[model samples]
Target: MSTTTQTAYLYKHAHPFLPRTIKAASGIWLTLENGQKILDATGGAAVTAIGHGDLRVKEAIIAQLDKVAYCHPGFYQTDIAQDLATFLVSTTHGRMARALLTGSGSEAVEAAMKLARQYFLEQSPPQKSRHHFIARQGSWHGCTIATLAMGDFKVRKAIFEPILPENVSRVSACNSYRGMREGETTEAYVARLAQELDDEFQRIGPDNVCAFIAEPISGSPLGCMPSVPGYFTAVKAICDRYGALLIFDEVMVGMGRTGTLHAWEQEDVVPDIQVIGKALGAGYIPISAVLANERVISAFKNGSKYFVHGQTYQSHPAACAAALQVQRIVQSDGLLDNVRNMGMYLEQSLRGRLAKHPHVGNIRGRGLFWGIEFVANKGTKAPLDPSLKVADRIHQKGMSEGYDIAIFQATGSAEGGWNGDHILLAPPYIVTKSDVDEITDRVCRVVEDVFTELQERGDIREVDSRVESRKTM
Candidate 1:
């Protein structure tokens, strides 16, 4: 690609010298300008669920465009928007009766936070309490200011410390790999974390806490981590005791990415408000929504006022149309079964191929979302320094091998403020067994090749820098 041509847009996430200019994309594969075929294993941040160039979704968008391209939310509601709300509500199994559509996941999260505040204002003891939100450390809700403030990714939050909202609090994430004590059993770990959350609520005064927000399956930020047994049940109990709402963010792992339509379903914990995105429109268009349960809705339904948030593209006709088609296709085509089967295959393949790799510390995931944690030593569980850019090297090596994967790097995971890197894999739901095999094989090859290159350059060291895992404290 010429510099002049690339100058049309400011591309981030990579350097200008090694730009991977894409020309066309089709089911699970992308064609580069240089004619290199790249397998899109990560689906460009796990957004492409039904795969690229899906004709059904394309037709749906075109049909919607023919009818109407846009409409204001406050004035009128279209059928597509209404139908999507109905479909989303039905999927919630009556736990949620109404929905609010947004342009993206961050907007949905922002709306959810406001909705919680509004709900409290409408309840008895109205305006009497609750201005704080408790979120788990290392969990990612979104990038918007409020969402970022609501989360506790220490590294990501460090730079914006001065400007972030002050009413947000954080608890230790339920990452079994890092949260479980040296000799503690899984049950003990759950009980401990649950107790800790309860303590935090009480310490802050239950009436002063608005909600407990979390990612059902922790996404890229923490390597697709999930809570251990009894964690959600305990968390739910504490929230109920405090009269705080539970908000689940399924931006990256929802909409059938986790076998179940909603990631929270597997845990058997129903949240009062659920934020869903990414796979919602299957990358065909930008769309997201917040599902509010009956209890929360009652606060507004019985109140004298309506929620005062709005976006120009809220419930956009074209985006909603595309998502509606994706939903129908997912159900009619029975893709959830495929997700379960392929997810199992991917997990088994990772264990068989890379479990014993000296530098590969952990392989954890569910459904189509997987993560490979890199370490300096497996037994001691030492992390590669952030300055070494181990995750970026592996990702570049994978790209060299014609595979595109996302490597999410976070500081403060290895220690209180130390950095750790992990490469995340979220393949399109339509991935076949062969695709899974190829993905694992390529990932393994890249990991080995990167390590070999480091050794050749005398960059692989024997220095001792072991520290406690971030979540333990």
Candidate 2:
């Protein structure tokens, strides 16, 4: 296909300046129309856990299509949907009771928010104080108006601020690298962040809060940063004290991306409601789901009214069938084990290569989901100017070098709302050791090339000067 045709035919995620037109994809590689082979290092925003072009997933989808492709959940529930729900609940130790599927992660988040509000109505007092949702400053739930307003990133919400919803309060995120005070212990930092959450609830009036939503492992906004130990335990305790539900947005970090079936599994905290997507179906088909435990389900079961929200395409048969097979493959192949092994190698490779880079201020993540934070100076921990768009430049360079990596950037995580830039690297769970090595090598080269190009263009001083400054500190 011609470049113009490819760009126009597809509602491209971004503009076509850096054209990445793919003719086909298989086994972690995409072939462009120009015959360039691009290694999918980030798995298209960490969605491809089983790698590209899986025969089993394709077969499942085909089989589902033969039976039914589009059946409204309101009118009929297919057997495939029921089977997928059973599989998902079984994977969670049968603790989860009900499943509500959606077309994407954002819809799942919206459902969770709505369900949390509905659950409050079923309470003995039928609390009306549960209107505000307290989310962290650097947390990302989804792109819906409710989710966007709950997040700390200002750029995405700037254009639609007038139409965005109100009543979502922001608090300091559980990012020790950014929010923790100097000389603070891990436990102290956890307590401090939890206290800040509680304070927000108090300021909003405890009775007016519905839930505290967060990602178990930070995605995009704070660069895949996981909370310090005991952080979630403290947060859960505070939420219970205030009668607010705790919602975990595991859309990016869950589904074996973090060496476990769920990122919250590693944290030892159970959420009242959990939102999962992306790798849930491994990108064979679009699917997302929200799981409610017995407590949350009981509220709905005992309530007089029906759960008041749903999508026409909720639990699409083909999507659920593909997801069922995708999840089964993850278990049968022991891919979570692979993620553990490969994640260690990936982490080592990243620290080994970029640990000393002048701009790489922090390298934090768990399992296969990693992020590298960039900075203008190490001593003051100041970010590069937002106008530079350093992350965007690196992404383009990396793509030109035949690697598909997503650049997750956010300003405001460092000092305020416009001072941070970081790129997230969440490779598929099925990535091999060789893939890990190549990813690190390509990333290091891209970082080097971009800095050199910037210096040549007189964008900044010597690149190594920042590295040297970091060493002295």
Model 1: residues with Cα > 4 Å off, grouped in runs: 1-5, 11-18, 401-412, 461-473
Candidate 1 lDDT by residue in tens digits, 176-251: 8777879999899988999899999988889899999999888766878877878898999999988999999988
TM-score of each: 0.94, 0.93
Candidates in order have lDDT scores of: 0.84, 0.83
Report the C-alpha displacement of residue 47, candidate 2, in angstroms: 0.5
Q: Pick by lDDT: which candidate is best? A: 1
Q: Assess candidate 2 and give its TM-score to the true structure.
A: 0.93
lDDT of 2 by residue, 381-425 (tens): 777766677888888777774544444434455654545778888
lDDT of 2 at 399: 71
